[model samples]
Target chain A: MTIADQVTGTPIAGTADTAVRAKTAAPAITLPVVGERELRLDLFRGMALWLIFIDHLPPNLLTWFTIRNYGFSDATEIFIFISGYTAAFVYGRAMLESGFVIATARILRRVWQIYVAHVFLFTIFLAEISYVATRFENPLYTEEMGIMDFLKQPDVTIVQALLLRFRPVNMDVLPLYIVLMLALPLILWLMKWRPDVSLGLSVLLYVVTWQFDLYFSAYPNGFWAFNPLAWQLLFVFGAWCALGGAKRMSRILASPVTMWIAIAYLVASFYVTMTWYVPQLGHFMPKRIEQWMYPIDKTDLDVLRFTHFLALAALTVRFLPRTWPGLRSPWLRPLILCGQHSLEIFCLGVFLAFAGHFILAEVSGGPVMHALISLSGILIMWGMAWLISWYKSEADKSGSKTKNAVSNADMAGGG
Target chain B: MKAKVLLSLILLCGCVAASSARAEDAVPAGPPACEVPAYLLTTESQLPKTAEIIRDNKPLEILVIGSRSTAIPSSEDSSYPARLQAILKEKLPSEPVHVSVEIQSKKTAEEAASGFVKLMEAKKPTLVIWQTGTVDAIRSIDPDEFRSAVTDGVSALQQAGADVVLMNLQYSPRTETMMSVPPYLDNMRVVAQEHEIPLFDRFAIMRQWNDQGQFDLFNPTRGSELAKQVHDCLGRALAQFVIDAAHVGPAQQQN
Candidate 1:
């Protein structure tokens, strides 16, 4: 079987002799194309993006329903982990079929694209916050959104913004993504040659970052909010799973013993998280244990957070099987669409979050207002995703038509 | 080596000249009464470490961690921390002072407090001016939780050997009408009193300025220009407040 078949878990039609012959004659080797997208990745990623939007707008009542209230890991872990899985699935195939040079070029091009999107998003986000602050005659908005630097020293701040250093508030995640994407080529190469070694290296980096206090410095002050060195472990682990690690551990993944352990861990996390709402019950735990787990550092990807995320992922995969009928339900279509166009949806979500905050502050910010703003923002996101998907589909149809016509003309000329 | 020495000499001369001018500018003989309101003044005992640092001719490092409004206008020289540094330097010309601002992005007091230990370790500032309560007030976080978070943050700063000063919420006419802030403000004061740390009553001070006809904070068109003036005044008041808290005076100056 081809490496693509091995990675994607798709069965090959040809015999072992045919596969051997194809491998010897590179011209005969055809890569196994992924005809269908992974529903689980898209569904969860879309949901996580929406949750991130709601969670960012503080004081909104919608935050209560987010996964964070019931688990140690929040939407951030889900988003980053899915990002890793998707990146590996997409790019690993390129490395296998098109050769390393083409794969490196493609990855770098993607990094550049993400970098540009980040800068564009930052500019638009600043403009939005600044306009609201000025229009409402409230300078506090600038301060609240972390855009005061740009207002004060546009020259220096613009440079820092370009370098992905001066991230204001919600702008930190894109910079983290940019850094991770830049390192994807090396990660893919290592995984291609030595999967275990690649994962080991990732773990080593995370441990060193935690033990030795290593992190990239942010511009005009402190360290990066999401420390890439520490967070890369989750991203790498996701990639490993996509690159045959999941299949290698298929027995363990399906084991009843493993399933029980995941469920138990999730239940415990739920109990612990629920206590946060009830202070008395929160303190019911022993003082020493509470103190040790008091500040689970989100920036450095604390061990508790990592373990909690793994447990959550395991439980999710077990419960929400790939062929679950609900994945194709009309009710879930919007979420699936948003997940399909995640990058665009994420950018829209950031803008909507800022808009939501402004609206909450301007309006009564009561329960009714919060509900209205959240529903409106989410609908807008879904609408935009649908529009983009429609446009892409139309473009694809037109291109295919043109190709077909050209082929017919060539055949007629040969006759 | 020679270039370094020459640069150092130039810097020393510039510092002396700047200090002399600042001393001249420090005199507030003709300013309006509302500009330096009595309610803004703190009679708490001086911060021993701050005073000692100034006395030793060392650069007093002050870290101001708060919302953007309290610290922004990005011109490092115009920020409250920068203004405070200038005010302190004018008061004690021989002592070089540096103020750094760290913007708190977290909305709740607890979330803001979570970063205190990390920041304290990183910055190693002799003084930490924590501006909080605005987000919590807007969100209507539980009063008890807000109190506990403030207390924990203060305790963490103290343990890190940094003097802690809590600054309450900014007075926004628009926000005031929209949400109640009494619980958060009262809780902050109680925490301050319990911890023996001085609470900078920014909300009251701003309210007084509006009530006393010092600044028309309600004016919607002024935007950042008005904010600049208010921040400048706040920086001056905070400088004096810190100096008084530190018990630094002409007599305490290092010769």
Candidate 2:
């Protein structure tokens, strides 16, 4: 019944049989029978990370190619969704096998790690911006990146940074992720017991928050850029799908009607985006309709953006199955690697994006310069991912080899 | 020796006279401080109504709808709008060229736009130069909403029988980092293009001046003097832009 059981390619009835057989035939637990890694998740997540890096630095021509220009939702939606799916996939199993307290502790540990990373990034990002600002003798750079407040009051700003109240530009996502991760245990528990009811409660919360205009107040002004109260819906939705929501929706997902609806919505969103660019198309759009859809708020995660993301996901799932051979191709390996080490790559990306912006701003900003910066930034990210992956594998090998050596010594002593 | 000095002085005078005469025959250049790139002043779009008013030798009533920057706080006469009036009067001595300013301080594009219909009915100017986007960028309003508001305002102005010239946000190196401006700037450009109107790229022109070291925008000590100089340059540039858009040169005037 658990995702872990499903991942091992055993039916509900066959799970007990497989466990009994494993106990009798083998001393240790068996490895997963099926490839449950879901390379699609990693590939998409990796692509999203790269896109986020690109989108963070403005005035780049590549931004025209990003999903934000073409559609309502962007890489942020994809990142949050996959994060939820993976969190549920990993922690759900832990909670089922070990216990609730242990699983909660592990989630808390991840939250702490993410919090530390955020603090580290905040410090480094401020230092980089401040150094550039002073070196170039352009205090505008500091003002431009919203570092003027930090300069005015370092002690207060540092405290605010630690509290996740103040963040410079392009450093918002990590804090949001931290808040979401902090709430995972409770979400996972409710999901385990009452999936539908829990999901209903999340939707209700979203609606109530919107109605009451409730949001975490950001430092030196307005609310959080990515309001956790609202964005938690997407994370919870992803987790639900990880549990049994996808299975429940299998029939609807496979239906031709649903496919056509999703396609139609996507086309509508595409047309709306086109109007933003080509104003000639905008004339044809009814004035009343334009008034109704004037401000599609990204901060609160408007319904249009949410549905657009859903439509996109639907089309993606319809086309790309789990068994797609392209998932294992050499071309996609870099993305998968980046996705596996997302936290490190993401932190690196935020730093790199700012660095790229600095290079473009201070130096020449020709098309060729942009090309060089973009390509080099992504290459560095890929290289970091590869390096981390290699180190992790080597560490795993050594860890297992040490265990084996310890056992061998025990055997010799016994003889 | 006195005769030789007199001869040199006469020669210098002759050269100066010849150059001045040539300048009169050619296009009259602006002051050194007001000099901007030709591309910034030139426009493909025409102010047809303004041109018609010039041809008819009618009173060219131009109303400027802008924020606080439109007027200089220290000296009102040194403001861009006032300087524009002075420049226009000098350029068209025969015609009564009146430039009036209406300050819509601390208002976003949407708010300013909502008042256009009523304002147009009252002012009834032949040309309307709308300076906007600074407040909108400061507030971080939705770009789509900003664009729509601009479109609405432009249409309303056009419908009111006024030629519209959009003036985008001011260029300050400090505020550039504090707010995201490209969206609003791009949206303004797109709206101007869509409506087939002229866009006075104030941001670009100011940036050009700053980059060229014509003005020290970073120095706080310059204060009111700096404001006056920048405004004067802007007014001169805007005057040239209007003249070019209207095609009111000697060649066209003779026709």
Candidate 3:
């Protein structure tokens, strides 16, 4: 808005300058606020990323603690949900401050970040796949790669991922997250222009996530991929909880009728989950898209998953502490720091993970060597993060030109 | 034609064993009677009261014993157990039957007896169809031992208030190894005769089909139309027998 000054009468830049200062940097940790926010969002994101690393890492000693055969599902559900909560917390204010234009820019930047991460990860995945393929090529199993496969595949354009209208075989959640973030501008627009409308729309999106599972179940045997539509309700739910929390939970908690309804809703959702008999268990409910009768693909959203997610969201929002007990522990300080800077730490963690797998499991030795390598990897990533932060602070000290780097980005964007 | 004739003879012989002399027309009415081929075990069939009993509208309880082949067909839609249930319902529409054709543990008649007793007690069945000896035939146990175990099983079912019927092993061509059925089937027939229980005589049906060139007995197709033909034949027969054994009468048939 500020840069496009020629089109408007109002001084968009000046208002933005003022709003930007108030919004860019979150409040400082005086007593417990920063600590609490970090735990609420970052801890969950931090832990999920950690599990993901362990899940992918090769045979190693760390597998004992890190690998989960069937662990906390909060992996995909909590990460995206936390994304929603953070989007609501940060972007909701952006919408209020600079209006929808900057909100669009913000959503775009976030999606771009996910896109960049995916491109980088895809390159690494290919490199590893090729390396392994050369060592184990057979009719049943091949560790071979063709250049055409990479060229044809990496060509799945940004447009396809953002629309979630394309599926590249063997990919995971990066595209899904990118596609979901594309909806942020509209979400914020609705939240700003009409809070009730936006809130209702979020609820409806959640219903879509629940209703869309049946559509994808037609494939033979089956597929293990997560449906983005089915999964986004967790984020939308987290967003709602972040934006609209109330002590007025007391109103319903003590009410006998509300308690009974909650109990009944939870039991029914659980039953549906256990049985997998809901039509959405295998495919999406098609009737919803048909006004004149049309087809809407969920891609990953299935009905029971949506309901199960919602039931979990409602229960967590209704019952969980404003600040978890784990947050209060001094022993968890390093975890808290790692959690706060999760994306950066995750990049480092995954880098170390590859090194761990190559050196330990690939070395053809006993597990003791693997354990040593894993510990060394963890410490190395931790040290690398600590050193980077130290160097960045030192650079800031010598530079006399600007306000904090965090604020500089906000100012440069004029938001 | 001779095989069909012989199957019909075996079935008639089975009817003769279970039906009391006066039950030629005085048999009780139930789901068992619905299997009378709609032609043979009719209201006016000249058989014992058990035949009359099978002609009536009483619920049928069928016990199927077989291996994975019988329990779960490549197409579940045509599994023998599922087919038998369909036949009982189609024939004895007035008498909705409960069919329990369990995966009989390869041996241990003592264990198989529970499933049999439970089905009989719940449905108060007038007839049953046993399809074991195929598995026992594969893992060759002594034929006499098989007979005694099966006899004990039949005694347990009769004690549970059931009119027991055993199906003789027919043919198994697909499996690499098979237990020869001549000894097992013959022993089962003797036990059925001694206990006065009906036997389905699937051996006779398969032999007839093979001789007629409808299917080769030992090398029949994996999932052939003949299997379904034999399944329907036995299901229809069992429903009629149950109805006759229930002593259903002509007046009830009209109503």
Candidate 4:
């Protein structure tokens, strides 16, 4: 098999090889594309996703200290870049070690994951709306809830709500993630397993998105809430850096130059976010940005929100410790272990959030009760995560024992 | 842990107190609880000035009556009457004076004066202001009654040894259909010249805003175009009237 055809265990490996090797020269910094395999990047991806969850929650006590409302809460922007970054890291490595076939399959799998996540979150959002509409006391309870009455239709307006809600400005991002994952494997394959070609396309996607507003978009309705297409280039750049492939970039990061730059960025983000961006919190305080941030408006991502998120994310990467603090400590090991199995943690978090909302949310109380409510929410989530991890560990141990027993029986039968 | 909790509690209380204190300062105090003064102001600087120059050396008690919160005060300090009081305080501090105003809605000049009979009796004020006639239009109380009420109210004050300044009332362009008193503002000059009461024509101020682009002297919008014009006009009028009246010397300064 030609270099591209030497497939790995995963089907997308060949294509992953091609994508990782592709390259594009950007003036700011050089990042060598890592072959498709970096678990640390996964940790970042998971962290970004987690931040998004917290960001989505209504601002109250826990979120207050968070730079969330500030311009720097660009946690969402980091998710997009990391999404692309991992694609090149994983898919490119797969392609080089294995083949295009493995790369393609893995790409589809990632895409499917995004679609599932979207559907799940969308349903959760819709369910919350229904709960509020039905349960809340609207004084105008009788006025022809005419159009609003459609909210009563069980799942009737689900499709329309998805389209019309226009939330997550930068529409269809969840779906976009899936589609990009699918297409990326091929894009990687076509790059002839070269870093330049893969990265060049990613940069091109970013440029088109940033300057030209290129996304599958409507006038305003379909503006991409998270312009992954544009942000993908940053991922490609970071991937290059992680692999130690971008020679010029590696030198810069090693030099004192990057340290100062990172420091300056950190200070600037803090200043702008606290002083300038605080007041703008009231702008998003109202629940109105829902209409265009969803569906498929890829073109209309908010420039303000996107740029701020990117700046903050970059600063964090440039400065925050590579490994989480206290992660190796025995007392804190459980939490880091949970992080290792993030999908399980996510599922448990969702379940816990729902249960807490249903059980404790209606109990009306002021700040004291609210503090308790939030406290319970955090504790409940952690509890569920611990339980799930424990169950998984037990099940795996049992499965290993059963497998060993069957193997011994087979050997005895042959004797 | 208890100490920490107590510290937190102290911090929380401090925050609450600070926020509330700031809010209180943010809004300037409104009219006092009782026996408040209403504003007296002129709409235009060019208009003739009227000040109830005290002759017998009694403190001038000025009262302004109005329709609503937004109604024109004689001046910006709520009424030109108050400004008159301020000037009196500055120029004649030892004159044993107290200037007071009361704003009332739905009262005719006679009604306003009659209500103040006890106050007039108590304060024995030497200066009276009759701001009515708009209500006369609203009630369509007889025009003759309006004229007589003005006369009677003024006579009542003067009989009590107080001089009077009448503020003629006008309708906003808003009240064409509701008013039945035949727009008394139009005929105020007749009453003032006939009664020989120094009528501060607030009506003229409205006319200036409508005709000459001179804004409402008491725009009430606080520094809005209307408010600025009223403030300017009333201040100038109060200043000029006081100066002119001073020239007449304290003896001839009567209603």
Candidate 5:
């Protein structure tokens, strides 16, 4: 199997050679295409997923571990960038092999799947909020969740939701993802001819977005929490890197000067973020500096945030090589499993984050309770990932048994 | 075991005495019960326009743009804005200090910000104190959007020739669990810093008060009377904050 197949997390169809190896492999192991896949991507994507889950819940001491506490960017950037990279890596191969028409069809199919997931998540989310609000006599749940419009005018809100204009707090990511995925076919098509110019076009769109203050109007007022126009730059940049940009910059990236520059940028961002928490640090920060740094706009994907994420990625690549043994460690297995099954795990995370928030708000909100809720939420995500992986492997085994008798004979001989 | 208990009691007593002593030091000019920390009351950003107006001995017109928190039910005089006006008038007897409140009830920062140019054109105050973030937080507006709105508002206010002081959300121990507040709070602080203006950290001050047992913020039994006391304390604290940021005290007068 190619690396593309592994990145997409779709195990190859049953063959006699693979069936023999599967039986010989450990009974506990469920991960498909482990050694061939880019473990670094899976590992970091998994870590980002966990961080997103933690950040979604109400703020607690546990939040200090999130990247937002230390830098300008957060898990959202990592998720989007990796998503772009993986999409391009997997589908670019498919496009090359099967031609553009087939690839575009597959992309649309994925977009439809995401759209369905988003609608489902939205429905369940509204139900959860309304149920909690009515059952507990705490109308704040509906209000605080930004579902008040839905509660008041379900008809209009449902249409707006279907149009992807209305979204509750923490529900913004999926809609943004849906839009990005829908645009990917075109992006991939453009990249096929000229990857660098395509990225330049994306950057131009970002600039024009800021210049004209163009954004999609959210329901009741304001704009999208994650502006796709500005954010598409990062996504396209990821795709660019996956195609050939990284290879072109391999020498520059390997240079000591580039590494030090990335390190300096990270340290500077850390210091700036620290000054937000510790006001005394403001004494060292000049007024002009503050003027330049104010409104580090996350919605529009500020340049500082984009650069910060790039710096982080640069450092990550430097340190965590693909051959790093830590990637294959047993401790990181749960995270890897979640990352491998990112879509379902992400949906689960969104649901569990609200549930966690409800428990903390309704029951107790002490430090101990915060710790328990955070740990258990992640444990549940991990458990779901493990179950899905196990089930997929079992299904694969059964399919192999039905399709090929030679594999079954090899499996029986190995057993 | 008896010695250990006696030692612990002595230590506790010493801690109480030390705290009381600190509170006493802070209470000479402020209210006896509302001794805010020096750091909480002070701002690194100075109100230059306000200081200039005070030094010139002109009428100090202060416009308070806020939401529901600016007013009290059935007792307009007990609201923070009213109490602030009273305190400012009492302190600056020579200068005609007028604190007028414009309540933007149930409005987010963006909505309120869009109204600033028109409001400032009419009001024309030397100092504008903006109390926001509660409605935005409750409504779950995007923090980045909220930050940009506040930035635009502060800029508008400054261009209108007013020294702006931003006030963040009120702290309630009960709602603290249900809603997320730090993003709004941090964004406000960033805006205040970026504009080189003082932010009146109402959330931090109130949270400090609750933590110190100065007020039981979680208790519903105290009701409006408790709200009155809290507003009064907030008014007095805000008055002091304005004075310090403007640097209009005896030391500044001598300078």
Candidate 6:
């Protein structure tokens, strides 16, 4: 029987049901039920996108409200982890149903799509910065956005951009994501064959990269801002959890000891991060120890940052279980919508951040202006998400209508 | 006979010295041959530890900490830090010099300063070249807060036994028109002065270059080549500025 029949306690007649029954009867590899969309992923991912928008505004007062102020990790970590989780959820299903080769193709196609989106975003971002610079007769914007190279050698820079080696400011993350997605097929294959070995390999790479200072180099000079070698550990860990790791840890997850540890870590991280804002308290640590602890290399996904994110994740999972109806509440609908259309919203956010910076600079960038710009930018993102959702719904409706018409005609002809 | 011999020798020596003076005068002094541009130099006090390191022929370590600008691209070796190392190596070939960069990544002076101790511990550079104030200026951060942050950062660097050279905001025509940079620049100067550390006047130097048409700041088509040239010049100027601050010359040693 089909999932729909099982859910509604009614028979769904036709060849589809019969095929599902035949498949179920054979039963060595039972198809997993595709359940309701995970509201928590959408909710949190949306929250991360918003935080990114606010934080990108630079000198804004509202940045204090973002997750960065309270922890070593920030929105980037959240966004990336969620991406890994969702990718596994979607692609894992495809592999189970459509088989390995098709799943690999699907993953590769996604990589291409993300790469295209990244290029498109880069073009628009560069154009926006260039246009603003020209309009104001200030070449500094080009310099500020790290586009002087492109202006100097468009031919070479364009080639580098296509290669994902030349990225402007706020444009680095997409490249990192692209690299991670490129490896998704292998990651999934490993997870399917040997889950523990896959995770072990990911961790090994993370440690090796951090220890040896290994990273992919950007064009001209320097290394990728978000080192993929280090970051892939988190992404892989997220996927592992989505596949079955979380289920294996159910006892530990439910344990009070684990809960307390997670809470304590979060609290301590919160205090330490706050001290960075308040110098008097910040200086309480010994210079030697502080120095050793600091400059926690964000590029390499330093161990402290990794642990902090883990603690935050643990607490989040504990408090907000999968059954938490609060995720589906009207109050969080905007976040859910944005999360659903994450790639589009993220690209839009990058543009809006530049616009916000421009507005803050051009207009009175006081607190009021900061607030206004932030609100407006977020509203625009929400609007874009809503529009995308609307378009998708309309297309789906059209598709269903056509299918229904074809079926009706077939029925009549058969009768 | 002895008096006559002495007078002849003295007369010969005087004539030889006079001819040498005339030869020196005939050679033109072109713009004081300033390896480091005058505009980029400030009257801040010397870097004692840095000088000692250079004078001892020990390795001179410089840590360049700033935003995206800290890592401007042309080639791996073209970054200001790499160029600075090359220039320093050329100037003090006997001394092993290494310049490393730590990107603050869109952080303000306050945020960047918070990580000084960590950077110092990891790199343990003798001299910390802080390129700051741009993000703060753009964000319109409070001058007092900016000053405090800079002061704290300098103090932290010093406490870690590293000499500090505060590099001020870069002059970008676009940024200049958009935000008032004076407050942040002035605050950095105040902090540097209070801390008795050298302040590399990147703003004044870039502005001078732009104003004097040394570099085409207004060129709509200014490309990576110009960026390379600017960074190269900056690297050379900064190397000289550090060398001067560390009191590396014979004149400084005599003083």
Best by lDDT: 5
Backbone clashes under 3 angstroms, per model: 6, 2, 59, 83, 0, 3
Candidate scoring better on lDDT of 3 and 4: 3
The digit string of per-residue lDDT tens for model 4 on A109-210 reads 555554555567656755654655455432111111121344556464566535433332112445555555656666555444555666677667776765
| Pairs of colliding residues, candidate 1 | A143-B68, B46-B245, B46-B246, B46-B247, B47-B245, B47-B246
Model 1 CA deviation exceeding 4 Å by range: A1-35, A132-149, A362-364, A400-415, B1-255
Per-prediction CA RMSD (Å)? 15.2, 12.1, 21.3, 21.8, 8.8, 17.8
Instruction: Order the candidate numbers by TM-score, best to worst.
Output: 5, 2, 1, 6, 4, 3
lDDT of 2 by residue, A160-259 (tens): 8899987665788989988988899999888877778878988999999889878887775445778899999999998888776876777888889989
* Tens-digit lDDT track of model 3 for A1-415: 1110011111235655554554443221011112224354555565655655554443333444431221213245655776676666566555555667876886686666666766665556446544543442211100011111333454453344334443232245666666567776776555545445556776676666446433222111123245555555665655555554322244665566765675676665444332221213323323232222111112344343444444554555456554668667766555545554555566566656655545532453334565576666656655664664565558556765556654434522322
By summed lDDT, which 10 consecutive residues of candidate 6 chain B come out lowest?
B1-10
Better of 2 and 5 by DockQ: 5
Q: DockQ numbers for every candidate?
A: 0.09, 0.06, 0.02, 0.02, 0.15, 0.03
What TM-score against the true fold does each predicted structure earn? 0.62, 0.72, 0.45, 0.48, 0.78, 0.62
TM-score of 6: 0.62
- Number of the top candidate by TM-score? 5
Clashing residue pairs for model 5: none
- Share of real interface contacts recovered by each model? 0.18, 0.01, 0.00, 0.00, 0.06, 0.01
Question: Which order, best to worst by lDDT?
Answer: 5, 2, 1, 6, 3, 4
Q: Candidate 3: how many backbone clashes?
A: 59
Candidate 3 off by > 4 Å? A1-38, A58-72, A138-171, A194-196, A209-224, A245-328, A349-361, A365-381, A384-394, A401-415, B1-255
Q: Give a tens-digit lDDT track for model 1, residues A1-415.
A: 0001112322224446544543554331233344455777878888988988886654335666677777778889998988887777766656665567877776766666667778887788667646554556455344332323346777897898898877766777888987887888899888877777899999999999988878787666556768899999998998888877876777887888988998898888787765543334744666567555645567788898899999888878878888899998999999888887777788888888777766655554444676788888899989998987787556445667768555332211110
Error of 3 at A267 (Å): 12
Q: TM-score of candidate 5's chain B against its reference?
A: 0.87
lDDT of 4 at A265: 59
Better candidate by TM-score, 2 or 5: 5
Residues A248-324 of candidate 5 have per-residue lDDT tens digits of: 77788888998999999999999987776556887898878887777677789999999999999988888888799
lDDT of 4 by residue, B46-129 (tens): 212223334445554555444432234333464455555654554454444455666676566668767666767776655565
Alpha-carbon deviation at B237 in model 2, angstroms: 7.2
